[model samples]
Target: MTPTAAPVLIVEDDRNVLDITSFVLESAGYPVLTAMNAEEALLVLAGHPEVGLILTDVNMPGQMDGIDLVRRLRESGNPVRCVVVSGDALHAADRLGDLAPFLAKPYDRRSLLGAVQAALVA
Candidate 1:
């Protein structure tokens, strides 16, 4: 564990998953930030510069989608690593883009934590 546990930002429109994921990360010893969409995510990221990882869904109801969020994050030269999880397999390839270690939805707890660890470690 780090002296200051890395903040993991979880962006998901689904309220259940958002809360569950936040709880998962929190229990795993990672600081977690929850957002319903890209707009809210941006607001959270703006204040907490310690954010070291992102776990987002592909489809979200907001001004910017998860792919756009990751792309924009990269465009801004932020080092925060990303893990895009979605139920849509067809869109995964395109949406994942340069972001590696993507997970399909309904992911197991181990897989989720593994992905988070990899992203944060990266």
Candidate 2:
């Protein structure tokens, strides 16, 4: 049998947030991979070429933050779209500038899903 494709990868250090995001995406019928940090996220990305979208938290435990991770990927010619979720709404756009869209923390289900949909279709 052919393996299922994973279209989205969620990188968040917070366990609860990760679980909730994964559940939400799964409920929407999108296959997802979860990673606690950028390092692990790279591994998941390497393993899942089908992943076309990345939902990540700006503040993470790894040396490379979410923005940096996305920057690296873009620099390396990886076309996977990224959406950054963070509590720091005031400057997330400035910090993440041109890398991807920024969704402030405490986002509602509609906002979250909407951002994902927009990024995917962008």
Candidate 3:
């Protein structure tokens, strides 16, 4: 499927953040799916092959955080694009390198949507 037409999976541990992000994307007319952690995100991806983008938080309560999740997907040859969000931008950028785009925590709706759109097209 074309990335623009596919769903965006948001993986975040915070309920408030997840809900708000989902709401923002959905309100803007993008299809969205959500998971609270990397494991759940993996499961959701397995079931939803149409998910073209993943917007995941770097820190989460699970065996694997967003970085590991992205790494695993890469190792397995999953081509789904990713946009990672974290409060610690420098640390996350150092760890992520060119793996995915990074968005800082407490982002405004426009920034969040812009990052997602950029990733989708990338």
Candidate 4:
């Protein structure tokens, strides 16, 4: 697949949130992959080089949260783009800096699609 058409890897512990996000992205014609936490996300990324973007929740039940996951990816020199989503937007944004775009939780379809599209092009 082309870079823009590459799959989006979503890391979310909440099954409902994961399902909704996947549905929205897939309905918009983007390929989707999912992991429940950062560890699973890392494994998925290692196995799927075609995953161009990561849309991850900030909080999860794992050794590494979403921010840590992005930091790990960056520290390891992975160039895949990322978008961080959280209900606690302020805290996440403060820590995230320019690492990735922040999309607040309870995001509507339009906002979610907009963030994903922007990150894909970025």
lDDT of each: 0.83, 0.87, 0.92, 0.94
Task: Give residue 77's error in model 1 in angstroms.
Answer: 1.3
Model 4 regions lying over 4 Å from their true place: 1-3
Task: Kindly list the per-residue Cα lDDT of model 3 for residues 44-122, writing each as its tens digit.
Answer: 9999999989999999997999999999999999999999999999899999999889999889998998898888877
CA RMSD, predictions in order? 1.7, 3.3, 2.0, 1.7
Tens digit of lDDT per residue, candidate 4, span 1-122?
Answer: 22377899999999999999999999888899999999999999999999989999999998999999999999999999999999999999999999889999999999999899888877
User: Highest lDDT: which candidate?
Assistant: 4
**Which number leads on TM-score?**
4
By TM-score, the candidates rank as: 4, 3, 2, 1
Candidate 4 differs from the real structure by a C-alpha RMSD in angstroms, to one decimal, of: 1.7
TM-score of each: 0.91, 0.92, 0.96, 0.96
User: Candidate 1, residues 1-122: lDDT per residue as tens digits?
Assistant: 63347688899999999888888888878888888898888899999988888888889997788888888888898877888888886688675766656788888789888888777667
TM-score of 2: 0.92
Q: Worst ten-residue run, lDDT, model 1?
A: 93-102
